[model samples]
Structure formats: structure tokens, C-alpha cells
Target chain A: MAVYTEVTDEALAEFLTHYNIGSMVAFRGIAEGVENSNYALKTTQGDFILTLYEKRVDPADLPWFLGLMEHLAAHGLSCPLPVRARDGKNLNPLAGKIAAITTFLPGVWPRRVLVEHCEPLGAALAKLHLTGAGFAPTRANALAPDAWAELLAKSAPRADSVQPGLGGELAQMLHGIVANWPRNLPTGHIHADLFPDNVFFLDGEISGLIDFYFACTDIYAYDIAICLNAWCFEKDFSFNVTKSRALLRGYMAHRALSEAETAALPVLAQGAAMRFLLTRLYDWLNTPPGAMVTPKDPLDYYRRLRFHNAAQGPAAYGL
Target chain B: MAVYTEVTDEALAEFLTHYNIGSMVAFRGIAEGVENSNYALKTTQGDFILTLYEKRVDPADLPWFLGLMEHLAAHGLSCPLPVRARDGKNLNPLAGKIAAITTFLPGVWPRRVLVEHCEPLGAALAKLHLTGAGFAPTRANALAPDAWAELLAKSAPRADSVQPGLGGELAQMLHGIVANWPRNLPTGHIHADLFPDNVFFLDGEISGLIDFYFACTDIYAYDIAICLNAWCFEKDFSFNVTKSRALLRGYMAHRALSEAETAALPVLAQGAAMRFLLTRLYDWLNTPPGAMVTPKDPLDYYRRLRFHNAAQGPAAYGL
Candidate 1:
């Protein structure tokens, strides 16, 4: 829940003058995305989302994110299309931050991961990967295996503060992931953070996907590995193989997984778990005093990493 | 900016089953109201606001508040009307809190008050009071003159912590206000808090009024006095008499002010300032450390109180 920047009325009115969407009828700061200030905006034309990129987002990558959405939408993918101003620019300045408007997609994110949701989610993920293959631009996954050692070094010092000897466990896990991580699998654009909250479902079908800020070029199977950790885990840290099987089956229906991709799933899943654990540990350690956003429990990923550490290849994930 | 209650998908789905508003398409917790968890809900039927009352509001008053909205909207006021469920109940339970849905009104609150906004605001206030006259239920203004002394006593001990010697000045002001507050003026239901943020405008017209949690029975002129301090004050802490004159003229056009009401405007305005100053000071002193919502600066009201203290009766307010 965040609205870090306050957009003034004068600045908003001035910003709207650049659009052909007619005068603003309503605008509200919505408690949605964590990295940006989002307003659920309604104009005489229609409803849209006005997002002011916050400091956490690198300004240089905004064109890539916006352009990726436009590219995906043009190819008939269900995603928010960046609305261009009358000046023909999708990105503009407002409230001392780069701002953009996008068409509002109507769907609620699933809070409870139903077994039926996995098929559509898996299908959408494969479609996103296939559709994004031809996009001209590329960005490296910042949280990939190579970056885990740096993350652990920063977070390992205080890991025991959250749980006794947790730092040593994380270091061992990071070392194993970095040494054995797959490098030969198929690579393409992946939603690196495809958490349940990022996917929207309507009428029990995947209606749209959002939060492309985490999109980056990475191993395609690694994206599937992220979903295995994100969608197949229960609150008690237990794996649900039924959900995993459904998700993998859904993806394979759209694009067949190569033999190398299937074989590398275990290490890839472990690396994926390590990626989240390190980041969550870093956030847990560095969250400022009185910060509004509560950091996710790094231990949840620690438990998942433990499972991946004990896994007997891709069969453990029901792949 | 608050969403105090977390509404789970299972609970929300169950809640929506009671309404014929169609299946839930989208639901997002909006950062609009401070007192409750407000979700911008979109169903197959249409858009609406779903509010879950937090602990700040009394549960017993839900009927009065919801009924008042129904009554006012029925009387042609452009405000959000409560949407009853299929069982014909507007108030229901959700997430262990009293929750209700209301029609979504389209308009943005003025972050920067303009002189032109004063006329429409004044006319709307008067119309609210007039239409609210026949509503049978009555709620006493909890922050009226009688409550000022208690509020000051609670805040005075640390008043100097905010501003040196502020406590003594507040005590003296409270004494003057309690002794001089008008009792014979015309009385009716009043929107005790008509700050700029609560009034929505579109195309320079007052499109809607909202946040009626503070509405209660009080002297009619006292409500005008609150508006005088709210709408007529510029950011620099200077009073804009032209705007004040237009506001008063607009109100008088709707319902003429009695001579006694006119004579008491200065004292009433001072009391209104004192009322807000004391509450703000209490909130400032008592806000828990690291609270998400920042308390307003009590000094702004202190300055307005000082202005009213030296004013030359109604003419000073552009009456």
C-alpha cells in the first residue's frame, strides 16, 4: 500500500491538457503498485491508470517497460497498453517524476491460488514468453544467479537477527546455486516476479497480467521455476505437486519444454528461491525504521530453498 | 491513505454473492479515506466504492450515517447513495467489520482551493443543511463548544512542545469561546468538517460532497463559520475576503442569515478555529510514533484563531 508522491491539482490539470482524453472527471491515488504512485483515473473518455514512476524505478528503463507493454498489446496479449499523449509521447513529466497513463484492465488479482487458476496462469506465462521473443530491446535479469553472492554478502551479516544461524544457511545455499545454475537453457523475456498478486483473473480465467517493471531477459525455464515457487507453495511452506503439475502442463501445452529445460528445472528452481530469499533478506535487514511497507518473510523462501536443496531432480516438482 | 482491513478473496466472493451486482471484475484498496478501508470495486454491473468501517467509527451510528446519505441523495443532492444488498440491507459484515457499498461519484477534490470554488461550495453546504432538515435522526456535534475545554486540557500539557507558550494562549482562547459561543442562532444538521478535500468539483461546479462522518446537529451559522476558516484561508495563512464574501453571499442566496446569526459570525469563526486547533493539537501530541498518517500542523489553525481573535465582527469576514 503506497502513494509515496503527492500529485497536486494544478500539475495534474496541466498534465491532462497534453492528452486528447478530455478533461479529468475523477482521479485518486490507489494503493496498488509498490514502486510507483498509481491513480485510478477517470476522464470524459474512459477509465485509465495514471502512474508516476517513483525513485525505486530506474528512469532509463521506463521506455523499455512502456514499449514492452505496447508491443505485447499490439500482438493481442492481455496487458495494459500505454496511452500516448496528444504530443505522441507515452512518457511525460508530472510532480517531479516521470508519469504515464495506461488503459485500465478489469480483473481482480487472485488472493487464494485455486487449482483451476494454474492452467490459465501457466498458459499466460508461456504466451508472454513466446510473444516477447521478437521484441527488439533486451534487459538482463538483475537478480539472476550471478548477483546472488553480492546480495548474500549484504544480507548475510544480519541474517541471524531474523533467525539464529540463518546467515550461514543462506550463504551455503547461494554458493550451491551459483556453482550449479544452468546457463544453456533457452532464454527470453520473463516476468521475473510473477507472484500471485501480479496476475489478474476474471470469471475463473486469466483476464490480464500486469506489473511489467520486473520483465527482463532470462532463461525461459527459470521463469517457470519462479512460478513453481510462487504458485505451488502453501502458507505452511509445503509444496502442492498437483498445482505444479497443472502449471507445467499448461505451459507445455503452449510451448514444449526442451529436454535440457526439463532436466535443469531443479537447479533453476533452487536459484529462483535463492534470488527471492536474498532480496527478502536484504529488505528485511534494510527496511528503515517506521517504513510503511512490511517486508515479506525471508524465512518463507528459506524453507522453499531447503525443499529445492533436497529435491531429486525435476521429478520433485512434478515436471 | 489507509486499508486497515484485509478482505480475502473467499470472504469477498461470499460478500458479493449477496448482491446482484454481477461477478467481481476488479477490486483495489484505494488510498482515499483515512478512517476506513475503501476499495474501488468494479463488477459486471458498474463501478462502486466498498467501505469497511474501522474502529474509529461507532458501529451504532452506521444506520444514521447510511440513512442520512440515502435521504439526502433521495432529496436531489449529488452525493453517493448507499447501495443496498439483495436483502435490502446497506450495512453488512465483511472482514469482521461493518462494510457497505455506495455508488461511485466522479470528481476530484481540489488540492488547491480557488476563489471560484467558494460560491459552489457555499451553495452546496446550504442545500445539504436544507435537505437534511427533515431527516429524523440527530447526532450531536461531538467537537462543539462543550468539548473544546476537555480537548484543550488533554493537549495543553504538551502544547509548548509543539510551540512555546502555546498552551496558555489556547487556555485563554477556550475560556473566551466557551463564554461567548452563540446559543440562540438557527439550528440544524451541519457538516462539521467541510474541508476542501471533502468537496469534489468538476468543470468549476461543486459536483459532490462526501465524508459525512462528521455531520451532526449544530448551530447553522457555526457550520458557515467552519467554512469561513476552511475555504477562505490561503496557503500563506492570509484570509481571502473576496472568497469569503462570495461564499457568504452564496449561502445567503439559499437561506438568509438572521441578524443575530450575522452578529455572531466572528465569535463562531473563532470557536471553529479553536475547535480544530484543539483536536489537531491533541492528534499531534498523541499520534503514535511511526504512524502512517501524519497529523496536520496545529499551528495553521493557531494562526487562523489569532486572526479571528482580532477581527471586527461579520464585516471582517466580508459579510
Candidate 2:
């Protein structure tokens, strides 16, 4: 639901002159992507997505994101391929923001996570990790264990306003995560924010994955940890062992997990939960009074953090 | 930018069981209509628009609206035709809201209203009036003259808060409009809200007309009067007589304006301006705090009302 910048007809027509995608037939601002403005564009050539990167996205890091998508797509991963203009550059300037066009992938993101969805998602996640090994660029995870202390500090003061004693619980959790965070095990490009909305399913299979803004170089098993939190949790904040087993089985079928990786899954899962909780808490306390997007409930992640705190080992995750 | 109701994947799949439009391939919530939840839906058959009518729209009038689009599209107007399901129903229930699918209309809405755009808009508008004559169902314009008094009364208290002496000025204007509003001037179905966004263009020609939620039975000349205010105003709020003349000329090429309708243009235009001003003023004053949608500036229409106030006759409109 973001269209922060309005692209005038004159500006768009001039911009399209550099593209060989034929004349524009239809263009619409789509309610996709929180950090950038996205438009579903149709032309005489075909359908595409025109994204205007808002200030939230760093222009310097755009090439890495675009390059990652291009690389993965070229290696047979299902993702949006950046459509280069006649100038052979995928990135350009439009409406005072960096803009690019990408081929439209066909699929609807599953609104309700199903047992059937977890297997395809797991396989896709493993394949993404495998294919991304050859990509040259390296971007450090911004919300890694090292950043949690700073985030928790920023969010601590007013977090109790959301719920009494919430800030104190988060501080305690952050202490534990920083102490036991995994190190030096299977590093590569991981979709750090592979939430259900980012994975598209078609004909009962994962057709495409999108929104790589949170993607960076991290332990491959940490990606699995993120998914265990995102996809294996029910609405009641209860962990579904069946879904977790399906997801893990699918991942293992593609690439076997090392013993060290398996041993660290609990801590990695706790760290992943901490990362989201801290950010959500920060956003809950600091979102502008009238911002369009509602801050996600931090308490959801807090409940998951509590679950991780009580878990014994990888057996708790049904791994 | 509305997706008020979230349609689950299961609900959508079950809903699609009734349609012959093939298996769902893609669905993205479109940031288009303000009063409804719209999604750009792709299927194995073709592309279409899925509209979920929000509570704001009267459910009883759904037939009239959908029927009118079907009627106009069947008669060769390039509007979206409602896609009927296997049960021969165009409207159904989805996510506890009334939903319908329509063939996607192709073309982009002009962001900058140009003189070249006005002529085609005028011709298309006239054609719409002509073609709408044979439609069976009739809907009275809900925002007509009778509704103005209530709207102004609702907005009058906070009017001066927006601008000094604005309340007094609006009261005076309302008096004049009520006294001189025309009666019985070639009544027919009219697109009462044919602003620039509702008209789409491609290849220097008008391709389609859309958003029939505001369509109703009203004076045909009043629709022209609405267009004159909508398409003939420059950004600086000055009347563009050249564009007005082009629009009127293109309109007359299709259907001649009778003397009575011509004589009533000034008051009709003033009423049109007042209609928008009062509604915008109401919204400006009544918008809830932290509402997602921003209230449009009422002063824009206040300026247009002032322009209509000084006009002596139809000649002032460059007719």
C-alpha cells in the first residue's frame, strides 16, 4: 500500500523510451513491498513490475540485490528476473527515486500456511542457499546477533507501554541470544525475511520467492531457523511439530545439515526470534502517529521467544 | 490503496471452483479504488480484476452497477465487462464481502491532464451518455443537489478552521446554487465522477472508462458540466478556455447541446463545483484521526467554485 512518489505521465513516457518493452498499456500501484513503491506494469511486450525504491533502500546495495536475483534466476531458481532496458542497465532514475523493471512472476502467496506449503518452501529455501554460493557479492546481515543489543537498548525505554514487563523480558532474552549465538557454520546468501508472504505457490508448488531486501550473507542453517519460527508456528503461538518435520525433511532432501548446524538450531531459532521481536518492539514504540502501515504485534514474537526458552534441543523442533 | 478484507487462499480456491476462468496463477492486491478491495488476478485463462465491494457501497445497488457495465461493454464501449461464474452470477461472497470479477481494461490513466486529453474524454463521455439510454435499471445520483444541504451542514462548523471566513462563503454559495440549479435538462445516465483517473488512454486515444461506482441517472448536461470542471482546470486553478472549447467541440460532434441545456451550463457547472466542494469539505473536517487515506484538499474545489461564480454565461465556458 505504498506509492510514496507519484510518477507523472510525461516522466513515465520519457522513461519508457529507454526500454525496448514496447509501449505501456496499463500501470497500477500495487499493494506490495513495505519498503519500496511497486507498480504492476503491462505493456505491448508483456507484464512486468516497476519498482521505485524509496529512501528506505540503500542505492549502493541495489546492484547486489538485483545481481543476486539475476544470478539465482539464471541458475534455475524461480524468482523475478530484472528486465534490463535498451541501455543494458536494469536500474534507472524515475520520479526522484531509483527505479527498475522486473519480469512478473506468476503465483499467489499463500495467505494461510498449509502442511503442503512447507515442503515446497523448504526445498526452495535449500535450493536458494545452494545456488547463491557462487554469487560474488557479500552483504553482512544487519540484524545479526551483534545488532540485537543496540536494538533492544533503543526499544527498552517505552516497550512496557505496549505491555507491562515486556521490555524486561526482551532484555533477558537478548542477553541469552548474544551469549549463545552460533558462529562459523555454513555461510551463504540466506533470505533472512522469508515470511509466508514472500513465498509464492502455484499448482501446489513454490513457484517464486520475492522481496530480497532483508537478504544477506549468513549461516545457511540460520535461514532454516528463521523459517522454523515463521512457518512452523500456529496462530496460537504453538509450534506445529508436523509442519516443522515436513520443512526439515524437505531441506535435508536437498542439502544435509551438519551435526554442528543441528546442535545450534535452538540458539539460532532463539536469535531469529530475538531479531524480529526487537525490531517489532522498536517499530511499535516509534512508528509515526499516523503512519499507513500498522506495526506488527511484538507480543507474537515474544510468545515464540518464550517457546524457544523452554525448548530442550533440536528434538524440540522435531528435527 | 484499499484491501480492507483479507481473502484467504482456501476461500479463493473454493470460490474459483464456481468459475470457468481456469486455475489461479497470480493475485496481487491492487492499490486502485478507494471504496473497494481490488486485486489484479491472473489465471490460466487470462488476466482480470477481482473487486470486493466494501461496506461503503450499498449491496442492493450492486446489480445496477454490474448491469450497467455489462450493458455498456456489450454495446461496444471499451469498459470492463463483469465476468460471470458458471452459475451465471457475477457477484458472490468472498471473505464476508460481496465480490465480483471483471475483464481487465487495458490503458493507463493520464497523470497530467493535457489539452489533447480533453477532446477524447469529451467524446467518450458523450458516447457513454448515448449508450446508457437503453439500460433498464436506474440509480439516482446519491450526491445530487438534495444531498448538498446536508453535506454543507455537516461541514459548516469546521469550515472556517480550514480557512478564514470559509463557512460564510460556502453558505452564500450554497444559497446561490439552490436558487439557480437547473431542472429537467435532458436527463439520462451520467458518469457523475468522470475525473481524469476514471478515463484511460493509449496511443493518443481514449481506450476505456472505469470506476462505475459513481455512475447514476442525472442530467446529461450535468455530466458535461462535471467534465468541464474536471478536465478544463489548469494546475494553478485558472480556467483553461482552450481546453474547454476543445472538450465541448468534441462532445458536440457526437450529440448537440440543446439551447436550454446550453443556457443552464453556468449554474450546472457551479452546482458541479459545489457538489465536490461540499463533499471534500465534509471529508476534510470529518476524517478520523490517523485514518489511512488522506483527505483531499477542499480548497481546490473552493477555488473552482469561485471561477464558476464569476462566469456570466456559457461563453465563459468557451462554448
Candidate 3:
């Protein structure tokens, strides 16, 4: 993560003065991310993640991000609670940006995930979805169906190709999708980035879920589609139909799908796939050189797009 | 993005002396990434990105990342050129991490990608593949196929309704693709992440390619699959066969595919699809609460995966 400005020990100590997490003792930088500078802090108060919101994270969103943690924690889901300052605010603008101390929860991310765990994740997600439903605080999906055509419209011209007539085909696909995406589905909060890195487990149990900056109002079942792609498939990149079923069964058990939701699954998956494919593609094409950032393979998601294109039905995903 | 420790502006000047760029007239945090802090630095010489490698960037591989930029630039790609320190070193240690400066190019991420850009992206990628061929630096695909499998193994237990029975099927699929991947077909440095965000353009032309952290020695065509998934498809998430053809055609124009590379197209695409689906899936299950990142939807790629899975020939992609 990016730590552009270094916080002195005294500065950190002073920053923690207002929070109730405890006393600052020691802090260590987490060298895994490419966005923000994070220090796994060990304070007399407790363990926490001391983050300086990097440029990538819009400063305006800090309170919303932090506020969600407090909200979710109070509602039931376990999360790292942002320690509010003496001013009775969770935010502490520091170093020309926002910074905060959040209580670090105790569960390690599961290295080995199982169907049983998927059950909990599905159930928890359902609960979270239900909780987020109609919550007073609302945000829109940053990358929504409406923006898809526009994003692709701009990027297609610059595509590198090995085929003579492929460019036209790409246009056709864009046109086709624009003509077919299902709208008017249930709109609510979605954990847009629910990857393995953000999950934490303890003794085979999904102890907590973190990261909510992308959480926004969108088709609720689209969240499930995102999960299907994330949890049910194998590393070889093929769908494990049975595992797919397990994850779905787990989800349905928690948040029973509406008839409408079921009908939209296939296309929603497509939308979701395209969303990722486009983002990966965009990131791939635009990543600045000489940066320490890593670029994901766009083809990786291209194959995924292929899957949803021809999926016979939601049943095909064992949904 | 998090400037926790405010530099008196004087300190920044001092620290910059150790940087490689000609001279840093002004610098400020621009964005915070999951991996690095990006600063739009206005050097007396030019605009550059001052990237401070967070702890996540392993120090050992810094050289490879640096060298790749030098190599790609030498190959005539318009990307960020790393600035060396006064000691004539490309690597610099700062804030308890690695950092560097890179020349900036001009381009706007297409708000909407069009079909026509696919061929150029494809063709340009072919050039990258050719130039980066045999240009071995330091890092291998740290998160290659094997590592992907290992990640799955760790998360398998958490699959919502995982059926190990499908493990065998997955294993076979893995074997099928692995046995046929174009390893030696055409060795080159592949811009693993060619997402729309990563590809830059000037006046709608592919002016520069960036983000080579995922660049590795692999079948150059695999990069094609990445782009097809990226540029050819629409955001609605459908696999536009025609668009796929265009992207492939674009790549073919720059570099003729070998029989092996052509033969491996579907398989490579299949593998590519699986890779994205898996990573997206992993992200779905592991989102860190409060982080602003969005997890990609795996269903988005499901259709693409099925296409590759059912591929009849390279002609399908118009390769």
C-alpha cells in the first residue's frame, strides 16, 4: 500500500489520543497492497490497522467507509470498528488527508475454503444483504450497468488484435449486451469487492468480512453472481457445477431468491463478468510503467465472459 | 494517498534527491492503490509518477520490475521510464519501502470503449509480445497457474457447497490446459493485465502501454486472450463472437501466430478465463471490510469460459 508521508511515532501517538481503541504500542507496515499505506498497529489500546487514505481512495468516502463498519458491527456482522476521536467523530483528518485507527479483528483469511464455509459466507452475505436493505445510508454502484457501454465504447478502438475481422465482432458483442441486460432487478447494497484477501476465518468459521468501499445499491442477486464466480469455481478456471450448487444452495438457504431474481441470474452474471473484464482490461491498458503495481491478465476474465454468454440458464450454474 | 507524515516540503525535497528523475519541482499524492502510492510529480524535467513501493512489493524482485520497464522502453513501447537515483540506481529505499519515479505519457482512459480500438490494442500487444520475447528480467509469474491452484486449495474448504468430487474434474481440466499451454510457442514478456484502465491512448491512438508488473515469460498469445476478454467484449457481459474475432484479428496483424500458438488458442483462453474467474471468486470471498476496492463478478466470465470450453477451432475466434 502507498504510504506517501511517513507518520512519526509522536504523530501517531498524538493521533491516537482521541480514539478509544487503547494506547499505541507498536506498529508494522503491511506490504501487501498497492493502494494505501497500512500499518498493523499494536497499541496498548488494542490491535488495529492504521491507514492513511491514499489518493486512490477518495477522501470524501472515508466517513462512509468507516461509518459502515460501525453500523455493520452494531447490526451483527463482526468487523474492524473505527475508533472515533475525542470529538465524537470516527474521522481524523491528518497529513492533508484522512487517517483512522480501526480495531483489528482476530481471524486469519482462510487458505483452504470449503463448501461448508461457503454456506456461512452465503448465509452471512444474505444477512448482510438483508441488513443493508433499506439502510438509511445509501450509495450507488460505482460501476453500474449504465456505464458499461460507455466504457467499452471508448476502449474498443485501442484493442490489439490477431484477427482480421475481430474488431467488428467486438462491436457487435457490445451492441448485443446493450440490447439484452436486465434492469429493474432488486436494488440494494452489494459488497462489490468480496475477494479472499478481505475475508477472515477462525477454526473453519467465517469470523468476519472487511472492505466495503465498493458497497453500493445495485441488483442484490448480482452480489450472488459475484460470489458464484469467486467461491464455487476451481483454480483450473472451470466451473465446478456441484460446488457451484453448494455455494448457491448455501446462499438460497440464507437469502431465498425471488422468482425475478432467479430469472435475472444469467444476465446479471454476464453484467458482472463484463464489469470485471472491463475493469481488468482498463487497468491492464492504463497501468503506468515503472510502478510497483501489478496488472491482472485481462484474458483471465475474458474466459469468464465467455462462460456467462452461453450459459443455458441459471440452472446451468446450479442456481 | 495517505500522507500521514506531512513533509515540511523541505523534507520532501531532501528525500527526492535520492530519486532517479532529473528534478522534482513539485509532488503530491495522487492515488492510493492496493499496492502502491501514486503521486503526480511535476519534475523540473517532466511529469512523472513518484511511486513509493509499499511493504507489499518484495524488495528482492524490485530489480526485475525496474528492469522490465527499461526493457519495454528499449523495445520502443511508450511507457513510464524509470528515473535513477544520483548513485545511478533505479531502486531507492524510502519510508521503510522501495520507491521510484517514472516519466508520464499522455492519454485518457476511454470513458467508453469502441470496437475499432480492439485491433490496434491487439496489434500493439503483439508488438509487446515480440519485443518482450526472451527478455527475461527477474520475477516469474509469482501468481502463476500453480499458485492459483494453491490459492484455490486454501479456499476450497470454504466453498459454499463444495463437492470435492468436482476436484477430479477440475484436476483433469487443469491437466488438459497445462499439457497444451503455449509455453515454448513464443516466449515473451506478456502484459498480463491489459485492462482498459491500464492501456493509455493519445488522440485515440495507442500511445503507451503500462503496468508490466504482471509481465512474465509465457505464450504471447495468452496475452491475446486477456485482451479479447478485455477489449472485445461489452460491459453487459456477453461474449461477442464478432468482437472476439476483431481483437484476435488485431493481434494476428502484428505477429503471425504459430501453429502451436494457434492450436493452443482455445486452451489458453480457457486457462485465462479460469484464472480471472478464480481470482474474482477469491476476491468475492475475502473482501476486507472498509477497504474501497471492488471485487469483480465471476459470472461475468462464465460465458467466456464456456465458449473456450466448447471451442471447435481457432477459426471460432477468427485467429
Number of the top candidate by TM-score? 2
Query: Where does model 2 sit among the CAPRI classes?
Result: medium
lDDT, candidate 2, residue A29?
87
Residue-wise lDDT of candidate 2 within A73-160, one digit each (tens)? 9999988899998979999999899999999998888888989998888899999999999898999998898888888889888888
Candidate 2's displacement at residue A225, Å, is: 2.2
Supply DockQ values for each candidate: 0.53, 0.63, 0.02
Scored by lDDT, the top model is 2
Q: DockQ rank, highest first?
A: 2, 1, 3
Which residue pairs come into collision in candidate 2? none
For the predicted complex of model 2, DockQ is 0.63
Q: List TM-score per model, in order.
A: 0.92, 0.95, 0.50
lDDT string for model 1 (A18-135, tens) is: 9888889898888766778999999888889999998878999999999889999999899999999998999999999999999999888877898888988889999999999989
Candidate 3 similarity to native, TM-score: 0.50
Candidate 3 residue-wise lDDT, B51-70, digit = tens: 77655467777778778888
**Candidate 2 backbone clash number:** 0
Give the range of the ten consecutive residues with the poorest summed lDDT in model 1 chain B: B287-296
User: lDDT by residue for model 1 over B231-281, one digit each (tens)?
Assistant: 999989999999999899889889889899999999999999998888889
